[model samples]
Target: MRLATVADMPRIGTLMRVSGAELFPRFYTERQAASAAIYLTEPDITLIKDGTYFVYEAGGEIVACGGWSKRNKLYTGSGSQQDDGRLLDPATEPARVRAMFVRADWTRRGLAKAILDACVKAAREEGFRSLSLMATLPGVPLYHAFGFQETRQTMVPLPDGVQLEGVEMTYELSQ
Candidate 1:
């Protein structure tokens, strides 16, 4: 895996859509999946620009993407007006693990774990004591296995009047 660039946005967006469509049905209702599909926005340029985003390529195809951030925005790329790009106080706030997705054909192969491990290591090196993420229903198991504790569950309202259930999870980095 390597850092993603703006040029990789199209492939990353495609991977997210394909992965979401295949995986969300395992936990979400059909209507919810369809409506919430709008939530699968393109890669956030800020992540790429910040050099925090990464893509895993195999057989010359981008198959997985994810990242961590020191920014206050917990999530973005859904075309929402919510992200403010404020810097996180790493002294107090946990680093944000954002936008994790794997290709439909690439699930359960340790790609997510690899990405998370990279993010955790990077965050720790950056002096963060903890990491946090808003995980979709399909991602809970992976995060849970990676030592993340769910702090809360909430619904994210999509633009199409549908809501996606998500969990807020955190992990404390071992010193």
Candidate 2:
């Protein structure tokens, strides 16, 4: 398992398991829009620029990945990169865990946890005290197991006007 650079974005973009348009409204219960967030392609650019991505693998195959954004000097809003609610304190680095998924063949293994551990370690090393993520329904328990608490429910408002229901979660990485 290792970290992925934006060079790995195309591959990671392909590996991400999407729930499909109907599934979004089915599982978390969201309203429809012109497009869907079923895949990472919708917001690929922002996901790349906003954060660094980590990839998990076995035998050189990319299995899972998630992105962590370090707080930047500027704040645009919740919908873009460099948006940290406009805080300038470096230690207050806010992060986002985006596009995390394990290959279908790799499920039930501890690989997800391992990848998650790496993300947390990197966040801490980057001087961040906390990290946030939008948990997919099936991934909620996994995040909780790693000490992430539910903060609120959210929606990733796609540029195409589609919004996917997500659980807003926060993880405190320090004492």
Best by TM-score: 1
lDDT, candidate 1, 1-175, per-residue tens: 9999999999998888888888888889998877655575457888899988999999988899999998877875334454458888778989999999998789899998999999988899888999998888988999999999999999877777787898999999983
TM-score of every candidate relative to the true structure: 0.93, 0.72
Question: What is the C-alpha local distance difference test score of each model?
Answer: 0.86, 0.61
Residue 142 local lDDT, model 2: 82
lDDT of 2 by residue, 5-24 (tens): 66776677566634233233
Highest-lDDT candidate: 1
Model 1 residue 58 CA deviation (Å) reads 0.8
lDDT of 1: 0.86
Pairs clashing within candidate 2 = none
Residue 171's lDDT within candidate 1 is 97
Stretches off by above 4 angstroms in model 1 are 77-83
User: Worst 10-residue stretch by lDDT in candidate 1?
Assistant: 75-84
State residue 123's C-alpha deviation in candidate 1, in Å: 0.9
